[model samples]
Target: MTPPDSQLPLGRRGLLAALGAAGLSASARPAPAAQRRLPLTAQTTEGPYYLDLALDRRDITEGLEGVPLDVRFTVCDTAGRPLPKLRVDLWHCDMQGRYSGFGEQGDDRAQSFEGKTFLRGSQRTDRAGIVSFGTVYPGWYAGRTTHIHFKVINGARAVLTSQFFLPDALSEFLYTQMPLYQRARMRDTLNSVDGIALKAGGTVLGAVREERQRYVATLALVVDPAAVPVIDRPPRPGGLPPGGPFPGSTPLSGARPPRPRALEGSARIRAMVPPRAEG
Candidate 1:
């Protein structure tokens, strides 16, 4: 059997030639830098809204209306080796900037969406450490820019909790031009001013491209599987921690964020693991 590209002993030029002969371009060859230990993916606050519903499915839109978006994530270790069998949970607000299963979100207090689940789901990585979701472009809310939240889990422990940001220009265009996103006024915060975005740096920005009918956004997550999990402490009363809820906005009501639920057992774990295969 032929060895995998990573196992090949070809030099740079030889690797390029091998890729070309295999009908792949030079870009297909893994860069030499990728062979080194990559920096751990930056960690960010898990804002007030996060629920581990264990809904394992690809399409998370659940009929919510907005510009279609296909979000993809690649998970690998700090040494750049793909890590399969890890659960990735993604959740974002709807076009109206309201998260499912949460009654109160950014100035809306009387609304009740309890027991509702949309724009949220979990999927495990395949052999190549890739997972994809079918959803809509996330809407913006006060105090924060347009973004999506995700968590990487091994067993019951969450190794990383971070958010993905879209380009400000693209977000602005969608808010102003798209009818579905026009319900709200322009987003008050942008990537530049967003405290979390600024702290997380440019690494959180996903590479997005326009497809025929939807937008595709992709991000790479490099984590240290053995690293200690960061504890998510609740923000101060009546507001988020530093760089949290935009200034002058209604302070978030003092409610403890929901704690993540545990996966069932070995059965649940097995369901999250994709069948092993080589790329």
Candidate 2:
């Protein structure tokens, strides 16, 4: 059996290197992004489960519980200025690897996880270009590793649509130790093996760690709202009704995700990791 990429464990130093190699971590102190040239967040497929639910809240758990995680995103522009009033939306599966509100699952849309709306919600960023969510650690499934999907929008315009990943070690611990998540068997995929992660150059992996009593994950997204290409595929901006596309929308295609520019230098960003478990 092949080893998982997360199994190789990254300390603060190593994490910084990865982020640097990906052109994500530019500085520890605040400086003009133009001077530092912050990289833009990479875009990924919205997948088949994306919905236009009219939800606006911080807690998307809908009552399921596992390891508590407070996910936050700092939305900024190339100038390092906060992008106030933009909306950030996130959705993920429960511990059982089952997503909500989908009657058909997977690419073929042959399975059902319908009648559920658990881990799906949107929160508008505050004046400081930050949006936070109260959710739990995601579990693994057959095809994909543990991850969370998110989108950033300024009114009707989509700024970025991407996913974030959890480290393999922590994901393994959750399934092997947590009763609720253990029900779904972990798969063989790793961050090193996930096509989207590879194509996005590791920027999709969130900087994560346990903070006090809960796990905290953060991602710094520098986006040029003016430059982000519009997504015209149906289920268009104002979002579609629950279980939408209303029949004439473009069909979800199996195309590859767009690849952004490669990292040009070797600068490093500090790493963040969860605290060690209590003995």
**Which candidate ranks first by lDDT, i.e. highest?**
1
Residue-level lDDT tens digits of model 1 in 170-214? 665566666667753445566655677778875677777656567
Lowest lDDT block of 10, candidate 1: 21-30
TM-scores, each model vs. reference: 0.73, 0.70
Colliding residue pairs in candidate 1: none
At residue 89, what lDDT does model 2 achieve? 86
lDDT at residue 171 of model 2 (Cα atoms): 62
lDDT of 1: 0.68
Segments in model 2 whose C-alpha atoms lie over 4 Å from true places:
1-34, 104-111, 228-279
lDDT (Cα) of model 2: 0.63
